[model samples]
Target: MKYLGIILSAIGLMIIINSCSKSWTDYSALQVQNLNQDSNTALNNKTYQTYLANLRSYKSSKHSIVMGWIEWGDKTSTANSTLNDLPDSLDFISILNPSNTLSDEKKQDLSSVQKNKGTKVLYNLNLQNWDDSLYSTFNKIGYLLNVDSAFQSQLDSVILAINSLGYDGVDVNVEGMNCSSCGSFFYTYQTGYYNRILDTLGKLYGPHSNTEKFLLVEGATTASLLSGTESYFNYYIANTNDYSWYYQVDNAYATIAQIPGFTNDKLIITTDFNDKSVSADISDKLWQYGGIPFYTNGSGTPIPSSTALLNWNPTSGLKGGMGIFYINYDYFNNDFTITKNIIKTLNPSGE
Candidate 1:
């Protein structure tokens, strides 16, 4: 358990940071601002009428975004399936685990994958599992990523190459593996990396800073169930407490409602619904909680695009959550194009 010390110290540092910074957040103020801005922007869009036309077709007030995941190692011919097939007006496209398990060469090939798409990219960098070798490697990676100056110089070279090529942002996807007592190390490592990235991005891009970057971890909730991991929450929670921390919950609608503020803005509720029908049902309940609902469609399949403008009048409100569906090359085609159009046909950028 040599790594245990690293984990314990990491968690302890996080606890101190959190306890001192808890009451400084003002989520209500931010929510009100975002709402006003969204509502106003929605009024000025040319697609407003189109959105309305589609709204008449459905009976829901829910607003959501449709997203597809593009894998990094996909063969070049089909690698751009999701991007190329995405509707011209679509909101965002997430580039998932671009190089999750790819060899160095394959990983390098993904340099400019999303350049022309003009969509927001959520680039994923998933760490296998947290075991000794993994932790050891990660510590090196941590240094390579957020610490060691010399090693980071090399890492930065590649990340910059990615930015020059086309990636919009980073999605640090560290999940699954076992990290022993180093659980705290994982948390500390994650937060530290986030801070480093934010700082570096700000310096590099200035006004175009990637600080607006999106970070996704598959199991943010499960970590707390660990023996000494709640402390991990204590540290990073302070920094992320105000921001939306997405919880990958499936069919947890009735279950999540009981969690209080969990349904509030601080959370993003993601579920795996195979299609539109189930996705709608889950979203119906999520709306009442005021939480954003993200639905995942399995690999290679795209959800119907018309989903964005569904007319939802839930006596309460339309589900006000974003959409997150799974995708791969197999699902690529004109069908998905229609789906993306459906999404854009409803929710345009101004809206």
Candidate 2:
């Protein structure tokens, strides 16, 4: 009897030890998947709304960051309305090429041109041709992948204008050019001709203080730039291939690794205005993969709050992060109530 009691006590002690060991060892990391290849599970619109409401109800201490792209020649009326009505929580807005969707008559507002003369405006210049005559004197443009003397001269002028306008730094969004020919574009941007332009502009723009310029670049994926790590630039990653921009299920893991150096601030993933139709599981997967949502508020229009973000629920609310539509406001503001519900549900701070 005594021997049996002793054996029973020993067994109980062993069981307790094993249980404690297992609990400690389970501290493994989260398993992330690709965004593109993953099957998108259809989202319940109601649930999405609920999610948004939950976030609003919880009212977490964190504030929602909102960023939009305003084109040069767009219809300013609607955009102006939204801008005037945008919640105070909204962050900053980026002004891309004004002519992205503006009409001949509306394009002449020159308000955009005046903008160049004042505040820090971000420019996105696509260089399919080397004609510097097409651009305005007060604009900030990001040169596309093509390189030439005309492009260099145009860029130099942009720097001068930055000084003349008393503005901030610039970003480069180049693509579609061969690896061999990238040197000029890089030289002009990677602190050579570009740096000289900036330095000269800074001297005039700021005799009182040091003016800092940031280097930003955009690419579809890490594979978008095949020149290996040597070809990488700073701040901007234009993942055109990404489905949701951030929650990429297809090659999401591989794509993230492809960028030689990716910091959250330096990366921007491309999402669509119509991404609400994408399933929640896929959306959640993207969040897990560290994909940031982005939209191009279609054509020279203000982004409609509804289309930019979708249904919101507690476990998973924010449908999109930053809005970058296709130079049109139609998609953004089309369904205002829906958009408002989506925004308020996900980020009540907007309310």
Candidate 3:
């Protein structure tokens, strides 16, 4: 009888321990599940926060700034909207291929149409001087936009005329920035001397209420990018369109956001969308760098290589959004179905 009692007690004790063990196991699993849920929620919130910050930075402006170019032949009049309203998604449109014939009346009309939609249309100029008598290939750029006062008087007159026209701002193209005559002086004499042009223009014409002194520099060279002249301008349109490099994406993020430390909010990266080799992946890589992204399709192919306006679906970070090189090129296709399709894809209108 004593032996049997002892055996029975031992069995009971084993049963109790087993029951307690199972309870702890189940509790541990529940705790793990709760932890996973918390982690997931935090990740989602981080992305949302990033997006909110980018949006708020622009003061309720769309997280993306949809922009494009309007060439002269593509429109009916100065302010024509046939090519512009295609996607109904543009935020900035500049008149391109400057013909050097902008009169005060013409500038007034351009502003009126774009203003109706809150679109910013700036006066786009090349080194080509509107004062044809003073024009040389890039002589105007060399002379007027130098480190010296060589062309300050001419610049003042140009600024006066452009401001009178009531443009939102200006876009200046510095072609052949690496040309021999751009001078060792640009590198040696002064830092960001090139920006003197933008600074002068910005001060003369602006402090615009909407754009906040809008001035953009196109075709920025490697020298300017490294020298930090770019920071002075509102937008720095870089020409590093080669996506074929294996580490191009990583390098771009590091170069802009990490090294020199400019976010997508400031940098505007260009991609050649017309290249068949670079299609959907372009926007993804550019977005990772945290800057405004734009792709180019030249006069020949009205059709975009990707047939998609943007390809960003932010889950963890922000994609400030992308725009096009030339809105007018769509006229070649005689329809914007292709562009319309693109702007709606992976976009707020995401497919």
Error of 3 at 222 (Å): 3.1
**Alpha carbon lDDT at 290, candidate 1:** 19
Best candidate according to lDDT: 3
Question: Residue 56 lDDT in model 2?
Answer: 31
The positional error of residue 95 in candidate 2, measured at the CA in angstroms, is: 2.8
- TM for candidate 2 is 0.41
The per-residue C-alpha lDDT of model 1 at residue 127 equals 39
Q: Which stretches of candidate 3 lie over 4 Å from their true place?
A: 1-60, 74-87, 99-109, 125-147, 174-192, 202-211, 219-233, 240-253, 258-261, 271-309, 312-316, 349-351
lDDT tens digits by residue: candidate 1, 144-181: 44434532553475376446545555543333445565
**Alpha-carbon lDDT, every model:** 0.34, 0.34, 0.42
Segments in model 1 whose C-alpha atoms lie over 4 Å from true places: 1-63, 73-82, 99-117, 127-134, 137-158, 174-325, 329-334, 337-351
Cα error, residue 49 of model 1, in Å, equals 21
TM-scores for all candidates: the values are 0.40, 0.41, 0.54
Task: Please provide, for model 3 over 1-351, each residue's C-alpha lDDT reduced to its tens digit, 9 standing for 90 to 100.
Answer: 111011111221222222212211111111221222254542234432342233233323434455666653432432223323333344456666544456444444454334323456666765433223333333434753432554465566556655665666777665334334444533353334445665566554433223454776555443343353344456645444444332444355444454243456555544432312223544432222222233333333222323322442223354444445555444334343334444444233221
Quote model 1's TM-score. Answer: 0.40
For 83-168, candidate 2 gives per-residue lDDT tens digits of 22222122333445422233443323333222211212344443323223422221234444333355557766666654443334
